[model samples]
Target: MNKANPIRIQRYLSGVDYPQTRDGLVRAAEHNGADAPTLEALRGLPDRMYEGPSGVSAEIGGDS
Candidate 1:
């Protein structure tokens, strides 16, 4: 998947907890009412524990 807009991705992931895995973030984003694009972008994230929003954003190749 290509890089998504960091700001938009973060918006949907606003309620996420730190140190969450990609699957966890997906669930959080779904619960937070993320749209298809946002969800798709999140699903594209690496399958690893993200320390924080910054880490997620960085992995997506965008500045938070």
Candidate 2:
């Protein structure tokens, strides 16, 4: 699940810039058609800078 999740998350972050804050990632994901689970996970993320999906994946318990 972890392995596949990042791949799915990537689809929503393809055009987003790196080093995004939690809010930025959520907004970006929403703009790119992220689903409820994705948005919920983003909302639960820590308030900090993130380089890419890997960091977000880790927060959601992915093996990043």
Candidate 3:
């Protein structure tokens, strides 16, 4: 899914600043209904996708 999509892994964890640790991201992803393994996979994605120059990018950017 697109990184900036509110329902995607990035947006779901963006509120917590892209989580410096896996556990943090997992918790955030759970709130968005992501399964544990899915959350772990998403957490391993590029940090740039989750953290923006500001907050979550207003634009979703290009495809992941």
Candidate 4:
């Protein structure tokens, strides 16, 4: 599968409250209309609270 773009992921994650968990991020991304690959990337995130977008990007190994 193609890797999801971190910048695009962040766009879908805009307005998400900080310190969000992986599940929360998934929900937020879904609400923002993230595509299948984006959701898959989000689902692959470590199950923990994310302090910010950078944390998410770091987890996914992509530059935002």
RMSD (Å) per prediction: 2.0, 3.1, 5.6, 2.2
Q: Pick the candidate with the highest TM-score.
A: 4
Model 2: lDDT of residue 48: 95
TM-score computed on alpha carbons, candidate 2? 0.77
Best by lDDT: 4
Q: What global local distance difference test value does model 1 have?
A: 0.85
Q: Which pairs of residues collide in candidate 2?
A: none
Candidate 1 clash figure, as a count: 0
Provide the overall lDDT of each model, using Cα atoms, as 2-decimal numbers: 0.85, 0.77, 0.50, 0.89
Question: Mind sharing the TM-score for model 4?
Answer: 0.89
- Candidate 4, residues 14-51, lDDT tens digits: the string is 99999899999999999999999999999988799999
In the range 1-64, model 1's lDDT, one tens digit per residue, is 7668888888888877798999999998898888888889888877889999889888887553
lDDT of 1 at 62: 54
Error of 1 at 18 (Å): 0.7
TM-score of each: 0.86, 0.77, 0.39, 0.89
